[model samples]
Target: MRHRSSASANRLPAPRKRFGQHFLTDTRVLDSIVEALGDLSGTTVVEIGPGRGALTDRLVARAARVVAIEVDRDLVQHLRARYADRPNVEIVEADVLTTTLADLAGGPYVLAGNVPYYITTPIIFHALELPRPERAVYLVQKEVAERMAAPPGDKTYGALSVNLQAVVNVEFLRKVLPGAFNPPPAVDSAVVRITPKAEAAIEPELEERYRSFVLAAFGLRRKQLVRVIRTVASLDAERALDVVTRCGLDPMARPETLTPVEFARLVRALYAAPSSR
Candidate 1:
């Protein structure tokens, strides 16, 4: 005899752990996130990890073009099927890291997503550095959002904080409770807005060097800046001291104490020094 199906059995698909899927189900929160995009009229939006298309539905109505990139093959099919009639929406199955924004949408676009927590930092980096979206709005872990929006001296402030802020102006929109999601993540989530800096804080040519310098400084956070600089840049004691002095930072200051501007200044000063030459 055949058995009758229940709601669980008939449900589209359960959240997958590996994919870090947590579908945003709360309509109020969903509306707020879309509204935060401020004027989406005629704008192109590249949405990463559009699982179950919760935000996709809202985005399609506002954006002139909506390119939804999903890593999970199952969800890709689901999203495509769901929005099949919507001419404005295009769904693609691919890992966000390999996919370039230009390849997805040609014109200026905003990056939006409820990003996978495991790949949150990597996604943010990709969004800011290449194909460089005009603006990015994401639903990320509350702690991660705080770190990205953190100021110079906050406890959470470190490499991620400095790196992102050096490129974009970040804002923490608001906190989102776990109840807002279908699976309900263990921790709360928050929405963040990241706007690309009109002008790069560091010279475009020196971006790589600047990044290396910042990573080194934060690698040994407890040490004085001079010592951390010497270890990372392979500079001697005297050269490190000289570099610190040139940047006008106190010799005893720690890495966490320096702002992004200070970090850029130090990198430039070190590069210009004869010792570095």
Candidate 2:
């Protein structure tokens, strides 16, 4: 809950490993964060974890309004004081995951964050859970950023990669060195920009079914995907294998080997299959 001030010159404070706190102190890094948010001024924007309002100041100057969500109590107080005169900036103290994005940010909006590494995946999904956003700018672990932006053949591809890519186009803005923060972190970080696809990935009904199926397939990742289906699909293993073949997937294959499209195809096949239920 320690908040670093922008004016303080001393090496702000090292990241607290327990809280997953990493204070971004490098101006060059901050500049890139601002730049990546290209032409978002006319619209509303939300920033997660605006420690000391470094990015908040830049965002407020450009956007119609800036809503910043900070969980750290002391930091929220500091932000209120810093932006006391700026009516455009609304600061909220709450956990980003539990806060409904659309309710917190009404209408369409863009999101920015230096998310705690521990909850990166959940937070990303949390943001996407709301109405489609213009784009999301995230400062996440370099490896995670890579995973998020990973192409089909990369070993980094997983349920997360498939899930995110199915709904959005992801691009990495820059790979940040550990030194960019107040206390350098053990791992490198990267700035990634994700824009939700103009077309919904699938119809709402199909999308939920796909999400459920994908989650099941990846649930027992080490086991063959058919094993997961047998447990979750209500279909017997033999029947699930038949559906897997109808969907053009190898019943023995692992979830990582399947593409997002293949997963969607499997969901369609499962729906078509006669169910014992």
Candidate 3:
């Protein structure tokens, strides 16, 4: 029943667990999410995982153009057929993460979706990597949404936080109750607003090194970063201690203790140090 499954006197199949299909069925919550999108106007909006078109209808109405990407082939056909009459809406059958900037069409677009919780990270990474998207809004797992928007020194802050905040400013929009979904997820969901940073806080040249360094530091979170660096690189504790001093970081500081800027400073200092090689 691909591309032909329309709501009939007899409804189509319910949410499928394999697709991680937790369809958002609450109309009030749907309106709230669209409101948070805020003035779609002439802008293009891309909806990821538009299961059963609950949120898709609201989004397509708001934006000048809408592209809905769905991985499930059955859903793609159904969605294509459902919105086939609307020239403004296009249904692309592919994983959202594989989609590139050029594939998204001419200018900056806004991204919105109730994404599958399992692949949220890669999806966020994909959106952040896009050259034209002005922002992204997602209904994600509540705990993860908090971690995505978390600041330095928080327990949730780490590679994901550092990498994302480096490119986008994340804000927790609102929490969504499990009852809002057809097949309620085991955990509650929340919305997050992603606004990309025009200017990076760290030097672009050292971004990868900085991330590797930060990840290495966090690999052994219980130990001081100085100790972890010695384990990750050739630098002995004494020389690693020297690099820490040059970077103005405390010898006893753990990965959780450093800010992104401080971590960048450590990256610069460590690179410049002869012992770091």
Candidate 4:
């Protein structure tokens, strides 16, 4: 089994196309990503898609321990061999989406990754699920980084913006051009830091409802709040108007114009409405 695994690892390409692998090669960008996570002297870090171990090399040096999850079996084998001597580094051969970070780390951990562009959003929200990391630093598509950190009135603000902001403080760190990667992605990428709020804007019990409400509102973002509330909450037109008015929001206001706090208020008002009950 060991011999076969070694053979398989040798045959596979460094950056597999199917995995959407674009390995970060620029040392400066790599340093910037690591720096964004702050000091990791005694911290455990869960790194997603540690392709070719470029970032992992830096992580293992600084972090107390590094649990690097790689989906590719070939890369997993390669990584295990590369870091076999390093007791602090654990190469996990598992899908990051399926594996729980808390279970792998066995305690609190910081999340960092140069995530695949195609699955960036899913990977992020997946990580943000229960037992969230101490903080997360991701090298994601520039557009997505903008959306995550975008303000209420910004053009990039949408359901993603509201949902993420409701729980975490987002910082758009810096942008990386295509040349930074081995097989450069066509589009520019950016690094973003996500730190979960000490006091979430929405309570844990209400998170599901809050996410659903925000998605529903942005689903019909061009429409006025009155119509969106009426459609999504199954409230009558008059009741919808009343709900929006009571929430201190303009009935004619579009969803994009509302802040995360305003969205939470509107959702609570909708839930309280008699028709919604």
- Residue 161, candidate 4: how far off, in angstroms? 0.6
Instruction: List runs of model 3 lying over 4 Å from the truth.
Output: 1-13, 130-132, 204-206, 270-277
lDDT by residue (tens digit), candidate 1, 149-170: 8888899999888888787899
Q: After superposition, how far is residue 269 of candidate 4 from its true place, in Å?
A: 2.8
Ranking by lDDT: 4, 1, 2, 3
Q: List where candidate 4 sits over 4 angstroms from the true fold.
A: 1-12, 272-277
Better of 3 and 4 by lDDT: 4
Error of 2 at 43 (Å): 1.5
- Give lDDT: candidate 2, residue 119: 94
Candidate 2 C-alpha lDDT tens digits along 202-257: 44456667777777777777788678778778889789888788777888888888
Task: Score each candidate by Cα lDDT.
Answer: 0.84, 0.79, 0.78, 0.88
Q: Return the clash pairs for model 1, or none.
A: none
Lowest-sum lDDT 10-residue window in model 1: 1-10
- The local lDDT score (0 to 100) that residue 122 gets in candidate 1 is 87
Could you give the candidate ranking by TM-score, starting with the highest? 4, 1, 3, 2
Candidate that beats the other on lDDT, 2 or 4, i.e. the better one: 4
Clashes of 1: 0
How well is each residue in 139-160 modelled by candidate 4, as lDDT tens digits? 9999999999999889999999
In the order shown, what is each candidate's alpha-carbon RMSD? 5.0, 4.3, 3.8, 3.8
